[model samples]
Target: MSGSETIGSYLNRLAAGRPTPGGGATGALQAAQGAALLGMAARFTTGEGYEDQADRMERIASRSEEIIRRALKVSDDDQEAFAAVAESYKLPGETADEEADRSEAIQRALLGAVEPPRELTRIAAEVIEMCAEIVGVVNPNVLSDVAAAAESARAAASTAIVTLEINIRAVDDEGTRDELRRDVERGEVAVATAATVTRRVRDDLAR
Candidate 1:
């Protein structure tokens, strides 16, 4: 899985009987798309008399691009981790002692699947916050694009949190489950905040 692989190719592989590149990967891709839209809005606003926010937009644009790149990489990581888990599941465990081995394998796989999406949720929340700040500041001509970015970020956050929840439910460790649940709650708060901010910005602009 080279970074050079196009999204279409990546998604095709994900859909092609592969266990990795599941919901976590899709959530990361959604976050990346949102980040890209944020960068686009920032770039469009940089010139054209939007000077007050030019420096901020430039910073946001750069950060957004970097975050998107990182997010895309995480998508690949999710796929790889999932594959590793699936492979572990195939290991033979015929003896009573092997029961422990199987449990360990399942736990490892569940952890692998959980961590990437948890990170995805955090990063998606950051992207959402950045978009919320820029929503009204960007070029009015590209307001819709800004809104789209915000919406994407919201969706990504929501999806990532859901993935986290699903994975947490599979974990036998109560402590780990509690921690993941808290993280998901935080991500949900961020998503809600971003949505409120975006909606206000959009409504104000319409009026």
Candidate 2:
């Protein structure tokens, strides 16, 4: 979607019958929102005595911007891959040769569907870690925003991981499955990081 598009419109499209902008896309969109919140918090922290940390904040902001863009594209890629998988299933398979071709196409499509969510899980985890760092450095007034960002990142990472896990099951290649399993393990660590960060945020809010 163009940067000019409204979020409401996107949500409406998501709710529509079309499957292009599905759960994986939503996960990416949520992470982008989290990234935007993190950038907003970082923007508030870049001044006065914070000059030393300003550079780090700028770097985070830049990377978050990139991630946001990539996530949106991944959202589109995920749907295209999904469509490929669905269409592959429809390929004619009455004959032996047709069955072989259809099977090959489906397997390739499954791999295609597996990739975007895996990348999304990885990036969302990084965004979550960035939130953990920002929670300490951001102005107290915007602490709540950082907290929201962390929560969103956690949800986004978790969602993408679920999508990844689901698609991984259709993949018959043991090597690819093992690699994705490792990615899931790493994503679980990211979820733990987000939980720890959120716990600190909760503590701060209580105090």
Candidate 3:
């Protein structure tokens, strides 16, 4: 999941039987797409009739550039994290000691894997917030893009929650599980905000 890979190439790899570039990576990309859309809308919210909102749009566009970079990095990191989990499962376990070691390794890998999607959920929340900010303020010509951004963020957060939940199940530590559950809750909040932003955009369009 190199950032430089073409969309077709990434899709081809994702469609393969491999474990990496799976749901987590896809979720990260969705967040990135949402952020990119927000950045575009913000950029269009400048000059002439938008004088009062220029500064706010500029700030959003700047922050969105940063979020897009972070999301792409998370996307790549997710593939590597999932690959580590897959490799941990391949560890030899013919004896009791080996089995214990293998189990420990798998648990450690699963714990490590949660961070990427957690970051993704955070990114989704940020994107959704930006969408909310620009929903009515952005250029009316591209107002629908705000809803599109919110929907993408919603999808990303939902997918990230699922990915994190699957990894959390294999993690035996109660404390860690509780922490991951909190993150899932946060992602759910972000999903709710995304829905709100989308609904607001829809109401605006209906008017």
Candidate 4:
């Protein structure tokens, strides 16, 4: 995206008949949005009356920025990874040697496709933890924003798990598959924990 494309332009590209900006890229973008919300919530909590929590909020803001920046990078990486996958599928598959080469390329590309989403999963978990930390401690005025952050982060983690599962199914190496499975499980657990905390925030907001 070159970091300069408008939101509408990006969405148009995503909606077009193209495979580059697929599910993995979208998952990273969602995580980025969640991180942004978390940062905003922390910003609201850091001034004047909230002096006691200033340090924590400042840390949260910093970490949240890093997470979102990483997510943008992940999005770009995922697009490139999937583009490679699409190209690999187009490799010739006529003779025995040709078929074998095509298969090898596809396998390698599939493995490459798993990486960006896995990194986003880790980042989303960190964002979820930050949301949990600031839920009650953030400015009461932006409690809804904090709650939204938790929900958005949970959604991002959940999406990463789905993307991981799809890619891991095609993985040939048992060791690599096991590692991917562990990552997916970790992401699932992180989302579940975020959901628990978000429910508390929701209940409190309701009261």
Top of the candidates by TM-score: 3
State which candidate, 1 or 3, has the greater lDDT. Answer: 3
- Would you estimate the TM-scores of all the predictions? 0.91, 0.95, 0.97, 0.96
lDDT for model 4, on a 0 to 1 scale?
Answer: 0.86
lDDT of 4 by residue, 1-207 (tens): 547889999999999988878778888888888899999988888768999998899998998888888999999999999899889999999999999999999999989989997897898888888888888787888888876877777777888899889888887888989989999988988888788777988898889
lDDT of 2 by residue, 1-207 (tens): 547879899878888999677888788888888888888888888888689898889998888889888878877788788889999999999999999999999999998888888888888888888988888877888888888888888888888778878877889999999988888887788888988888888899899
Residue-wise C-alpha lDDT for candidate 3, range 96-160, written one tens digit per residue = 99999999999899988999988988899999988887786789888889899899989999998
Which candidate, 1 or 4, would have the higher lDDT against the true structure?
4
For each candidate, the alpha-carbon lDDT, in order, equals 0.82, 0.85, 0.90, 0.86
Write down the worst ten-residue block by lDDT for model 2: 1-10
When 2 and 4 are scored with lDDT, the better candidate is 4
Question: CA lDDT of 5 in candidate 4?
Answer: 84
| Residue pairs with backbone atoms closer than 3 Å in model 3 (clashes) | none
lDDT of residue 144 for candidate 1: 80
RMSD of each: 1.9, 1.3, 1.0, 1.2
Q: Which candidate is the best by lDDT?
A: 3
Flag regions of model 4 displaced more than 4 Å. Answer: none
Clashing pairs in 4: none
